[model samples]
Target chain A: MVVLTVLSLAMWLLTVHDANFSRMGQLGLVSILGWTYFVGLVLVTMGFANELLRTPLRKTWLLVFVLLLALYIFGTGSAVEPIASLPDSYRHAGLLEFIFQNGYARPHYVADFSWPGAFSLGSVFVAFAGQTNALGFTRWFPFFIELLYLAPLIVIVRSIGVGRRAAWFGIALFYTTDWIEQDYFSPQALGYFYLLVIMAAVFATWRAKPSPLFAGLRKNLHFRMARSRRALQLSRLKERGADPSPGTEPTSLSVFDSWRPRLVSAAKARRPKLVSVFDSWRLKPNPPIFGTQVVIQRRYVHGRVASLFARLEGRDTTKSLNTVQTLGVLGLLVLIMFALAMSHELTPYALILMLAGCLISRHLGRPELLAVAVLLALGWLSLGASDYWLGHLSDIFGGFGQIGSTLTDNVANRIAGSSVHQFAVNIRIYIILGIYLLAGVGVLRRATDSRVLEVVAVAPFFLLVVSSYVGEGLLRVVLYALPFTSLLAASAILPQQSGLIRSWLPDFRIFRYGRSSHTVIWTLVFSIVLASALATTVARGGNDDYESFTKGELDAVNYVYNHVTPGATVGTISPYLPFNQRSVGSVYWVSLYTSGSPTIKEITTGLLQIHAQYVVLSQSQENWGEIVAGFPKGWESRVFLSLATHGFHVVAAWPTASVLQVDPKIAKKG
Target chain B: MSGFLVASAASLSTSPAELIVMVVDFLLLSIRACSGVLGLRLTSRDSRILTSATVFFVALFIVLVVVRFKSLG
Candidate 1:
């Protein structure tokens, strides 16, 4: 494992060294990344999968491999890029600089300042680090934030009560499939971090204790609903027949030979008729393992220190805490939730839904947590961030129950950039669908004590109904659900079919590889892990063509920022330039592509209309024009020529970017 | 009404009311959290007291928000 880790790390370093940002094509950073990167990714993924399959799982080794895989997937972009990949990252830095200089957020200046927790803290960090701006933090924030997610993700995967191997596999799968680019330098990233910690604390400290409210609700529905009636009858019949225990060894035979004898016996024991379709659709009784309390044992300081020195440690998934310690954790979670409420607009609502799901599934002990989350989120939106929605109430509430339009806008419209980009988008859709499919199988096929994971996994999808989050609602939903969904997906590959769906589906236990099964399970897992990682690499970097900036482009933008006066409008054909890192509110920006593909006359008219003092024509903007907007080749050059004819001239030029300033005389004439 | 709401939202930037509300809310939240640990059991009548206090605080918080909206109005 160590050798494989070292080899993969070395290969990653080589890939990073070999990468040239100048060569990045329409497909993004992956275009410039060579074979070494892919090879390294496969090596680390294979190592993690192999370790998971081994008995008495090596915790330290698996940790090393997973971290290595994280670096390969999340860190490579930062290491290879000349600057940060996204313009929003630098714009966030600009906001941080604003706070750093002013010592407070500019309320009502922008929507971001309305929820200013992340930027305010970032300002303090910048000052403490003796930096004037947050540009240093922007370059590698994705990698850093992902590493921060690991601690909470670990606790979450462990406390969900999946098998040790499946838990670890889920962690690996989560990192590999996390292609969503929200981990950039933003409030959403920090809010997501807080969300994960809250989930971990909740999962680790509490066990499902059935509430009378839900139980009574279930009882009323059981008598009132037809499906519930079938489910009740099926539950009674399943309870009467065959012992739903793992002790029943799986046999290698046809479906009839393996399952019929049990069905025949169950039929004889009960009525002599087979289960009807409605009965088969009903849920079977939960096995004893399903509802068992998962105790997360508390760790003492000395024990943690001792374990640090220990060479090999067994699985320590159970986090045990006494009442006082649990209270402390809960207090901290509340603080984090409050901060989350103040930081991001959407995460608090997502957290509220997730906590509601936990309450419904009986995973949470106290329902007050949900109430408090709702209050804080609503209070902040109404009181603290009133500046954001004061005149835009319709923008916030307009998309209510518009799930179909949200899907069309988020999914269908995004799939039309270019052939390569469309392929990346399609593969991303397929990967998400595949994960959800596997999660569905795991929910149906695996025996579990609690359905908390399934409930929490599906909870974030409700965010889709509110589509006003800049069209990124679906992405955020998938990201928030990925950790639990990944665990459920892992269970599909290694299902515990002890008491779950014994008759409706073929016994996957035959492939559990106790004695008769071969390497098929491992092969399936390996293939899925590798394919997901490869697909994620394509999807994650698919936008790099315009998202990533070169050193020359950054320099050109900095030159413009240094020279341009306040209140001046900067124009670009696309929002792909790495500007907006200074004079944020005073210096405005306009994108020409918002009105779709512009002719030379339209470009000239648009720039003149905005009175843009400086216009940036960069390689990334050119890439966006060609790839995403389907503009003709060298369209930017023709636009520049037309601009020159209208008295805009090149003030500065770089290898990959150029800046043009409109003459004051020409601007006045226009 | 929209103009009034916008003016009230704009006032939030200059007025210290929003800060005062947030600080007080945080203090109240701390109290609520600590009450759970200071020998108040959820199954006891004391829990009803806690629940009532929580409800009152929430109502007061909402009122404070409304006051922020209406104070300038």
Candidate 2:
């Protein structure tokens, strides 16, 4: 019940915020003033009502009130237009195009480029159902994926005999961290989930009882020794009896008793008797053969020292074997990591560490040492060999003047070379990677109980101090990596201290609230409300007017498409439309369509070889000057004027740029 | 030429690399099949299939080279 209430309230808050109540005219004012008063009154009334009912009715009532408030908020907010929003980088050009075009099948050309077009299809299948887009689906995808990642973690926690609630807390804390949020939207999340599954399996096997092979061998060895001893004892008993009968011998109990005394005498005569308190406690009828030898040697210290040496050697040998095994595991893991890193995908370093740790613990008997070694290896490789560390170091240790110059140059280059959109993409990737690496390390530290936390905590501090060594961007990356590391440390420290606090203060209400599922529900609700509120705020802000395509360029492109024979060449200054239209002719400067590239000649030659009949010059978002400059000298002036006068013949002109057509002969020569 | 002959002789005494690869592949397949069977049984009994599967794979790998080889070979 408490959980439901908290969730409902959180949802209400999110909705209210999203609605931008403050910006609304009469309706917004009424909502803010009227709902606030009603909510306050309901809360006060619920307290008294609960007392009257002799139950905690306040929470239920409060939840109902919050729900009502959310309804009003949503009703007003829905009247406003939804802000025209672009999809996230990965979602926008790639997945969004696939979803819009193919309707979940192998359809093409939703975007200017094909790479994202391919990748986006998969994401569309995951995010949407058929042609319908549902908010519920989007909201719940993250939770389901998170639960999948937690399955192995729960197994590991259970293996250690931790309570279900504690395991849930640990897993929940991991999923809720900022790092998970960053990776949740990417393929890297799948890799991390798989790693967890593998680790859980290894840990379970490690803790299993001795294998059937070992058990069978032991049983056979024991059986043979027992049989031999029984036969020898029987022969002695028969001799002692001295029955002298043909078929049977009479066994004498006295012979066996006297045998013990003789053995004792023989042992005493051969070696000096040593007495100790522990001797009385020893449950042996006769001293062991090894003990007798020790007495004869009269070298107690020598025995002790030799045994110690044997133990040391045994441990050393075991460590050596473990080192070899760990190296094999590490090799496999490094390959996995390199593949992920090279792909610009998120790496599940935490899951890898936990798995390797558990495997060492179960099979090799020294998980901690193996974990430390693997960590040391990773640190060396990443810091010593990887450019990331070197760049960071250079920025930090280098003088202030150098750092300033580096920062200035980077900013200048970005401004000169790229658009705001491109800069945004770079920032997003860096932030995501920083969050992922930090969070991964945190999760690993929690799972393995390793000192990775210490290293991670100090990492940011070190980076901050060393910022002069590389470039200005190093500082930003360090800043992003720090908060995540600190959050992980806090998560690790909290559970240990929560119990102590509960015991000392002993506030029943507080304890009950903390233990209740209310917090989780409320958090979910709050997030929904916040998102809606933000959406409303943006919507109320107002809209911009801009045509996505210009009339003149669109006309020209349409003309070329209609007139040009199928499979005949057509050249367009607009590289995007050619790819979109699936034109048979040369698409001039294909390289410009993607992020900046250096192979200008290669792109041009490929275009010309295709026998493009129509050359298009678009004054679109792309640099038209650069495209024209690449054209042959003679055709340049004519092409430029033809585009300006007859641009209307072009197929499409986006709000930002115009498109132009080129003669077929110009394409053939080029 | 002598070194090549000696190396060829050594190689002929042992199995080819491809054969080793095939053996590894077969071993892994068998282990996976065995674990799958155990997992199905565990599911019916309300026990965790994951635990049973983990144990099965580890046991298969550890004992295969030593005990399984002695018997199968």
- Best candidate (score: lDDT): 1
lDDT of 1 by residue, A12-97 (tens): 99999999878888787788999999899888877877887777779988899889978878898899887898888888899888
Clashing residue pairs, backbone N/CA/C < 3 A, model 1: A290-A448, A290-A449, A291-A449, A296-A318, A296-A319, A296-A320, A297-A318, A297-A319, A297-A320, A298-A320
- Supply the TM-score of chain A against the true chain A for every candidate structure: 0.83, 0.35
Q: Candidate 1 falls in which docking quality class?
A: incorrect
Residue ranges of candidate 2 with Cα displaced over 4 Å:
A1-354, A357-589, A593-649, A653-661, B1-19, B25-73
lDDT of 2 by residue, B1-73 (tens): 1212332344333424322433354343333334333453423223224334434544444443323223322
Interface C-alpha RMSD after superposing true interface residues, each candidate, one decimal: 8.4, 21.4
DockQ for the candidates, in order = 0.14, 0.04
Q: Look at candidate 2 and tell me the lDDT of residue A651.
A: 42
DockQ of 2: 0.04
